[model samples]
Structures are given as structure tokens and as C-alpha cells.
Target: MIKTFVPAPFTTHPALEGGGILHGFFGRQGGISKGIYDNLNCGVGSDDLQAHVLHNRQVLTQTLVGADRPLITPYQIHSPKCLVVTGPWPNGESEQCDALATTTPDIVLAVGSADCGPVLFADADNRVVGAAHSGWKGAIGGVLESTIAQMEALGAKRDRISAVLGPTISQKSYEVGAEFRETFLQHDARNSVYFAEGAKEGHFQFGLPSYIVDRLNACGLAKAEWTGQCTYLEETAFFSYRRTTHRQEPDYGRQLAAISIT
Candidate 1:
């Protein structure tokens, strides 16, 4: 039987493009899933049917790499763990890491996210590429930094690495309690710049994308940019964990951001 495929289109950043590489920030479109997963949900950890998720992943691999190539993503646990992708793991959910880097060709390195910052990195001069999943915890714990280090080990240089942050929750939609603000402040008092007073007395809105971008810039990459797209706001196009929690839904789908050396 022929598997039907919808047009799983994706967005690209100039920083990661035109360097003998494949990169994309995919949304919730052009897949075979249903209900909350709608379409193109590439997360295997979600409660969505395993077959549907696998089908979506198969299509995702075909789109980013080739039908014969592989797409590998880690079993994310919101930590700073990063791995160098030397080969594809037998199970997509078996490797437990939040970020990945590789000098290998033909395999797509990807991370799943819904509002969390999905960061893609490439140093074409070195033929090294990386992908990272950075939520608030991962960001504070240094996942981005870890990813950069891993890529550099594979011969990527900081001055030549181009990083791009894909869709994430914006400040307006990311109100946090005073304790959350305190957490950032404790991590570094200067982090106050990423928070703004929320409507509530003890809450502040957090700027996730900007914070992630700032962290990348601090690493001295050649270029770092946020797509300026908000996953929480674009309901129809992207899946969002925070948005699902707001509506008291059981679970939400996860979009994929991936990169690879051609």
C-alpha cells in the first residue's frame, strides 16, 4: 500500500541555509495524525498513536534527508545533556540527550519542541552541524553551551557557526510566577532583562526566544537569530505545551526543527 503524504512544508533561516546543508523548522501540517496531533506531529514521546508518530517521522526523514537516509532526535528530558551523533540509534526514544552535534553526513539531527526553543547550529566550513532543545531548564542549565562545545569538538568553530532559534513561546504568552523570576535571578541577576511585569501582582512574562538568542550570541557565533515566530500564538500551525495546559488538554503534539550537512 502506498502511504499518503501531505505537504510537510518547513521554514528556513538564511543563517543556516546555502551551506551544503539541510535545515528546517517544521509545523503542524501535512501528516497523517488526527485530533490534537492534527498533522505532522513528529514526537514519539507524545501520547499520540505510535504508528501515526512513526509515519510522521518517516515522512519527516524523507523531507529533510532522503528516504534512505536517517533522522535522529534524542529522548529529551529538559536537561543540558548533549551528544555527538555518530550513528543512528536503533530506537528514536532510546538516546537520552537534549542536544546533538555531528560531522557525519546524510543523517538529519533534529529536536522536538512545542514552545520550547528549538535551536539549529551549523558550521559549513567545518562540515559540522548541531541541533538543541532548550526549554527554560535546559537553557539555564547550559544546553546551548554544551551543544556548541560538542560541535567544536567535531571541528566547528564558534566564529563560523551559524545558529538559529526556531518557534518558541514569546514573553506575552509566557507569564511566570515570582518564584520563576527568582530562579532566573538566582542563575544570574542580570537575567532580569528578559522578564517584564505581568498583569498579576507576583508574575512576570519571560522572553524565552530572546534569552536563547542572547545566550547564543554570548557564545560568539557568526550569526544567531530567532525566527520571531511564537508557537503559543500560532495555534493552527504549531503545537504548544503551555497552550495545551491552559486548555487542560491531556497532551499536545510536538513540532520538529532539524539540520544536517549535505
Candidate 2:
């Protein structure tokens, strides 16, 4: 079985209902990449060999979705920009966006992540789906809201949309400097609620998923939940940017979170 970490509030698609599947694969246990990427490194941008990355992606797609289903992913520029996809985009044509949405069936919507959050959204009623790559910058810039708007544009009702934030760096492992905190507060003083004092004097712990959840709720989505798996703290199961930096490793792996209607 593919033991994915799924959020409790988001309902799984019933086999009989055929609503499609929303799921994510944690990085670490499988694949052919070596060195800093170790095993199961799916990130195309990483220093890992393209052949190895392609093989890893192929393995994941076969094991998770199916043999022939292509996983759709964007270039992920850490912007709030979103793309409305109708079908499989041409191979190697990267979009300069952080989010993607579609109302079509069978094509998998995918996003890559290491320390950042991979957010997946679905509306079974309208057959609309979306995926987003949310780093601190993208999250603060309203990537979540942009995704919601795109889904609504595809005829998805806000009240029927269900979203889940996959594994990411939690507050305990995400220590940031004073300037980082200020950048958020500059946008809204209420952003302080997502920050807590860290061990160091000038640093603070940032709650990434909490901010994501708050944004989803603020957008009036009927259901939003986090898988609550902290990437930095769980080295055996996840790849973390902070962890890689701490070890002085050249590059790190990335996990894929995906959802599709079929």
C-alpha cells in the first residue's frame, strides 16, 4: 500500500463514486538517485541525473497513479501566479507560476516540495482541481487565494472546495531572522500570530501550515487541513532544505504531492 499522510477532514474519493484521488508521496524510501539526493529524489532541478530523476518520476507515477498518466507540474517560481490547465501541457514547456488548476479528468496535477508546502485542492461537485507550491513568499503573496479564484472560475463553488496542505517545515523546525518576521507583519500585523519566539534571541519559529490554513479559511473554503508532517524534523521520511544546509550538502531531494479527477 502507498502509505501517504492524508488529512483527516478531507474526504477520500469513494471507489464507487469515482471522484478521483488526492494524495501525496513522502520522499526518502525509494528510487535510484544517489549522494545528497540519496533515494527517491523526484526534483528535476536538483543536481541529480536527469535519467535518474525521470526514472524516479516514472516509478512514482506507475506506483501511485497508473502506468500511462502523466504528472503535470509547473516551473514553480515562488510567485502567486496560477495557471488554468485544460489538458496535458507540452513536455519540457515550463510555466513561470506556482499554482495550477484544471476541470478536466485523468490528468494528474502535481507540485514539488522540499521545505515548502505542497497544497492540493479539489471540488468533487464541479470536477475542478488544483495544486500549488507555497513557500513563505508565495504563501504571503496569496497563492492560496489565487488558486481558489481559479477553481471558482472553473465553476467550483467555494463552499464545496476541499483543500489539504501536505508535509512541510513546521514552526519548531523553521527558525527565521527578525527581518523575515517583519516582512510578514508589514503585510498585516495579524501575521504575528503565526510566529513564536525561538531559542535564539534574534530568531523566531514560523508556523507555515498554520498560515496556509488561515488563508484557506479566510478564503471561505468549506474544508482545509494539514497533514501535520514536519519535513525538517523527520529526516528519514522527508528531505529538508534547512537540514541539507546544516549538513553542507550540495543539493536536496523533493517530494511530489498530486491530485486528479478521473
Candidate 3:
């Protein structure tokens, strides 16, 4: 059986309101991908068998999301690109984007992540939803802001949009050299708050989801939250790029965070 993780910190808008449901940050717990990508690896880019990945997605659709709903994910090129999906786009098409938005019911907006942040946004008042994959590049490039604008274009109000960030690599496990820290601080001095002192000399730990939340709040959304789960710290629960590097693994699994209107 597929075990779906539920986001406990977020409150689902009343089902009567026509707003869709958002799932928690899911990890590698239930599919059939073997070796390093074992169990519940939804990333098509991974070396996992394409058939196994498809089966895993099917399991997620039937067990976690309703069987009738179709999940939609973008190509995720770590850019600020956002696509407005009215219906299902081609499945597994690497279209070179990082975000998706839709107002259609039973149309799931999904984002895959190993270390990057998966942000799910919903506006119950307008029945609009969006998802974004926020890596450092995408986040700095304004993917989250672009997603909100796309949702607003679909009739969602900025004040009515609530964004939830799924599990990602927390700061303590995300050590970076001076150049990486300078990249952010040069963009905006306020970004300093998202960095902390790392264990290594002249290095800093970057807070991935914290920056994500800051961007969401700055967009004037109703609420912005993070699940506060660390992918690198929790070996059994999530897949992490840094963790894979530490263990000398070939490739890591990718978890899926999805939301769909019913």
C-alpha cells in the first residue's frame, strides 16, 4: 500500500468551499523503484525504470490523490518559467519550466523535489491552484512570484492565496562556500537572514524553505507555511542530494507534493 504523508501544519480550506486538497511532503516509503531510487521515487529524470516510475505515479494517483484526478507536473528546468495548465498537459514531457497553475477540478498540480522546495498554492475563493519547484536558482529568479501572478491571472486573489512549502534540505545540512552566499547577499542584503554559520570555515548554510516562505509572504498571500521537515536529516523519510553525496550514492530519489481540486 502507498503511504501518503499529510501536511499537518496546514489547514485545509473547508471542502464546501470548492478549494482543492493539498498533500504533505511525501518521501520514499511506498513505491517499487529499486536500488538508490527505491520505493516511491516519482522523478522521471532519475535512472529508475520508466515503467516503475509510471506505476509509482499511478499508485500515488489512486491511493493518495483520487483515481479520477490527473496529476500535472512541469519539466522543471530550475527557471522562473510558469505554465497555466487548463487541463492535462503531456505526461512526462520535459517542457523546461518550474511552475504550473490551474483552476480546473480534479487536475492535480504536482512538483517533484529531492533538495529543492516544492511549494503548493491555493486560492479557495477563486478555485485556483499552483505549484512551483524552488531551487536556489529558481527562487532567486522569482519562480514563486511568477506562480502567484499566474494564479492571479486565473482569477485567484493574492490575499486569498495560501502557499505551503513541503520538506526540503534545511540550512544545517546545506553548507555552501562563500561564493554561493555572496550570490544571494548580492541579490538582496535581506537574504542574509536565510543563511547561517556553517561548520566549515568561511562557509554558510542556506535555508531553502525559509527563503521560499519569505517570497510567498512578500507576494501578499493570505498565509505562507513550511512543513519544517529536513530531507537531508531524515534519511529514511526523504531523498536528499547532499545526503546522496555523503553516502557516495549514484543518484537520489525524488518526492512528490501534489494538490488537486475536487
- For all predictions, the C-alpha RMSD in Å is 1.5, 4.4, 3.6
Residue 92, candidate 1: alpha-carbon lDDT: 43
Model 2 misplacement above 4 A: 1-18
lDDT of 3 by residue, 27-130 (tens): 78777889898788889888889898877776766655546467788887999999998777765454679999888877667889999998888888788888
Tens digit of per-residue lDDT, candidate 1, span 1-262? 1255544788999998876898999999878999999988888889999899888888887777655467888999999999998778965445888999999988888999999999999998889999999999999999999999999898889999999999999999999999999999998999999999999899899999989999999999999999999999999989999999999999999999988777
Ten-residue region with minimum lDDT total, candidate 3: 7-16
**Which residue runs does candidate 3 get wrong by more than 4 Å?**
1-22, 90-92
| TM-scores of the models, in the order given | 0.96, 0.91, 0.90
The CA lDDT at 259 in model 3 is: 78
lDDT of 2 by residue, 57-134 (tens): 766666655544767889999999999987767775767799999987767778899989988888887888889999
| Cα lDDT listed for each candidate | 0.90, 0.81, 0.80
Q: Rate residue 71 of model 1 by lDDT.
A: 80
